[model samples]
Target: MTKVQKGKLISGLSVGKKLTVMVLVMLIPFSLITVFLLYTLNRFGNSYNLVVSNVAIANQYNLEFREEYDSVLYQMVARSITKDMINEELGLTNPDDMTENVRQSFDKLVTSSTSQNARKSAESVLKLLTTLDNRCNDINNNIIKGGAYDVNMSALDNDIRVITELIQERISEYIYYEAGSMELIRSAMEAERIKLIRAIGMFFIFFFIFVLFLVIYLSSAITHEVDILVGEVKSEQINSRNLELKLLQSQINPHFLYNTLDNIVWLSEGGRKDDVTGIVTSLSRFFRTTLSGGLDYITIKQEISHIESYLQIQRFRYRDILNYEIDIPEEFLGYRIIKMTLQPVVENALYHGIKNKRGGGTIKISMHHQGGDLEIDVEDNGIGMNSEDTANLQRLADGLEKAREDNAGFGMANVGERMRLNYGPEYGLKIESEYGKGTIVKILFPKENSN
Candidate 1:
């Protein structure tokens, strides 16, 4: 029972054990009552049958006594000397036969009778029958010796009548006692039936109420816990997204800066002072705007400035091989965008597109408004991708591809996921590429002013 309490004890039990306890709690009482009730009913049936049989036996004993007594009285009054009468009395001449008859009758009485008093009274009646039978034999012998008239059978007749009345009284008492005992047993059976019904009914009512509360308690507890878990998961996801965004914003592209510094060193060795100054200044401005005071979102104007610095450095390094253009309307420059959104696309064009082409190519950055949505496209006329490579790039940008040590795919995927998380799924990166011709990447988001 202690295991059923809502605590560590109940949690320790398995599902099967809990169900077993519940079944036993209700079933054991019912089983006990059923067994006891059946036993009582069986006892009542046996008693009822015994009483009926004993009553029938008593009636038959009375009838047999009356027939034998009347026959002897008629014979003695008429002075008859019938052979059948002499033979009937001669049968009682053997004391063993008389004793055997009494024994058999008493045995039947003992076997069938339920009450001790009833058995004792039946025993007395059997003894009286035996005595009366013996007396008749004496009267029969006297008649046989001196004839029925000289026998003086009045004494025998009176004796037989008195004994018959006594036997009748005893049988009546035995039957009355048996009837009373049967009535008492029946009353007890009725009481037990009522008690069983009440006990079982009360147990079931309490069990039902307990089960109702258990269901309600368990349901409420589980539902409340599940709701709390979901809330925590959502909160964690938002925090993780913000942390990742900050980490990405603080990251400076070491490879690009390293190559630019190497180019600056080469130019310094060649005595190109003005070119070194221009590259160093652009690199400074690029890193400054990329950090953006550690904020996740920045104005459209700042977004353009960072990408312009990046393009300038690249153009200085490539000289006559690489060219680029930016055509964002002034009216849209005050609007907001996620920081570092365009720079990664511009980087992808430089490394994967324009860098791969033999003659290099032009990279174009443009912006337009369609309905309430703002769209920015980065198009490159360089060595673009085939269908498979385009699909692979899309997978990387969507974060379906796992990151490896040397992979540069995280930048595009991070920017796409950030926009989606901030605004919704409707705003993210979309890619269109044609094999060996060009590639265009479009970024879409709702038009909102900088705050």
Candidate 2:
């Protein structure tokens, strides 16, 4: 395949697969190199540790030997030094006390040795120490037999010097051997450390290149798909807005239509020809404005006229009991509003508010422009809603509660949703009512037309 096609194929893979591939590509080689590097470093570390341990053991051996040698020298020349401290110088001697210090030095090395080599070296040093201690004891015994002044002092010095040389010679041999072994181990460790530094440098270079490739590839892949999804989302929004407009128009005033036709039938049966003709004309005008060729918005003048036709038909049914009035500024009449918004609010005021009253009532539709919004209030001087009903109506209007499936509470709710959908969240219904007094439903709309 061509390079472009290959890139497309790779990008087309699901995001999970792409991420999995990226992880594997980065992880495998780095993990292998890291494991090998760790193993090599561990081996070098062990080698260095062994060298340190060996040196410590050798130093301990040397220290013990030196201490024993000094004690032996003290014992051999005990008559030449202080008589109170050593005692042999005045022909007064204690052979048992003199040997006690020498024995401890030999015992320490055997107890402390951890390795076979260290133990073997300690054994040799122990043998040399025993001989030195024995020679010193023999000289002390001779001093006790001879008087201090008649003792052969030069012969005593010569004998002690010979044994001192043998002990020094053995210590020097082992120290020299351990130092040589340490030097060899250090040389190997330094070489391995240099190799590790070079490997680390190469690893970083490879890792940096892989990281750069991943950032570029993943960002491009994500951005391309996101752009496609964003376009689809915008298209769906337009379709949804159109569908909402259709739904609002579909919720026609069924109660008004059937009731108006029933009024017309009653009028005909009574042979009231002029009354039937007037009611028929009002009904025709109401439907004509209501349909408006399926348009979602209409001028405020047409909306006002539509509601007038509705009230006229209702007036025929209730006569003296139902009364209504409209007060809108001429300047505001030219502006447009979502079709069917005002009618449902007025209908609610008619049936739910006015009809339940003891006597006849009036609904007043008022409109004005305030700041950037047009505020329309539908006020009814009828038996109004209780606090619970008022709150329920507000919730229904704000879409915080669901309407009944039978569309029982849909009248004002449909109006509220259309206002929200058309003008956005800030513009919708506000309801105020007192149980026995009246209801004033204030609807706020953006001054601009939905069209």
Candidate 3:
């Protein structure tokens, strides 16, 4: 019942925050693509290097292995070269040393080769080299034991020559199989590279589309919120302007101002200086509060003064039958309300309620708190309407029914409209009346502090 903080409430992210979110959203996909691309490139580079290096090492041995081992063996068997000459000519002519060199190359292959076929072929070549070493050992043993030339030559042909030829064939087989594997690996890597590139293209396209969707969604949402805020502000301003116009229109009414001026002239002709002074003073206060310096709102105290001034002028006009009492608490007087709200309702009471009765009755104004609302009731002991008429008046105030020809409740209807327009539909006029008793017009307002 104390204060109200009023405005249209909208929920969403701010523009700065929205942009930051969009940037982060966009960066996520881009970052993923960057990391994936780097990882794929590095993976492909390592695979290609491993395969190319294996092929190069295998090629180096393919031709040289057979030439070096076979030439030295043949020259030694034919007696065309001695051990010293072979050693001088070839730094590694010994069967053990020659086989060790090939085994070392096989060591590299076994350690680095990923293909099972290539590893198996390398193992086969190494076994063949071991067999050749055994053959060389047998030939050497026979020569040391003073074996015959014919037997040594036969052993070279049947054992050493055949084994060396087999070894050569095995090495060639390894190179052949390894070369084919290298081609397969290269094809696979090329295919994977193409697939990864296509995946990246698709992901980038999805990222672009998602970002565009967010931009559109956020832009439309912001525009909608702005539109609501603008519409509410414009509606509030129009309501205030309408209320001000009604107040000005009331001021120019011939029955209201012209009659009051005539009352002042009559008071002067009768030499009633006190009456003239009082009416003139009340009229001045009424007009001043009506304009209220073009402000939309006034304090409860100012509204009280305005209504009191209007009643005073009326009291002079209907001095015999018009009397009013205000019973609002002092604590509630500082609260703000729309200007000229109560005056029109009180004027309507004077014209329709009090004037219709045999003799006008006193209008009592009272204010009290009802839950979170401030309720101001203007009660009049006039010829009150039946329940049906009161219901009709309530309907008209709610704008659910058309206007009546009598125009009996037009002022109060306008008052209700102004209240609902400024505050809300739930805060407006509530009418209660009984056929034989009295009518009380309650105006509801959401409580608010002035300052």
Candidate that scores best on lDDT:
3
* Greater-lDDT candidate between 1 and 2: 1
Model 1 RMSD vs true structure? 50.6
RMSD of each: 50.6, 45.2, 50.2
Model 1 TM-score, all chains together: 0.44
Relative to the true structure, candidate 3 has a C-alpha RMSD (angstroms) of 50.2
- Off-target runs (Cα >4 Å) in candidate 1 are 1-250, 449-451
Q: Give each model's clash number.
A: 0, 1, 0
- Evaluated against the true structure, the overall lDDT of model 3 is 0.69
Estimated TM-score per prediction?
Answer: 0.44, 0.45, 0.44
Off by over 4 Å in 3: 1-252, 404-406, 449-451
**Residue-wise C-alpha lDDT for candidate 2, range 6-95, written one tens digit per residue:** 899889999888877777786676567557656765674565455445444444544554445455445545544432345545353443
Give per-residue lDDT, candidate 2, residue 405. 28
The C-alpha lDDT values of all candidates are 0.67, 0.64, 0.69
Q: Which residue pairs in candidate 3 collide?
A: none
Candidate 1 clash pair list: none
Error of 1 at 247 (Å): 4.0
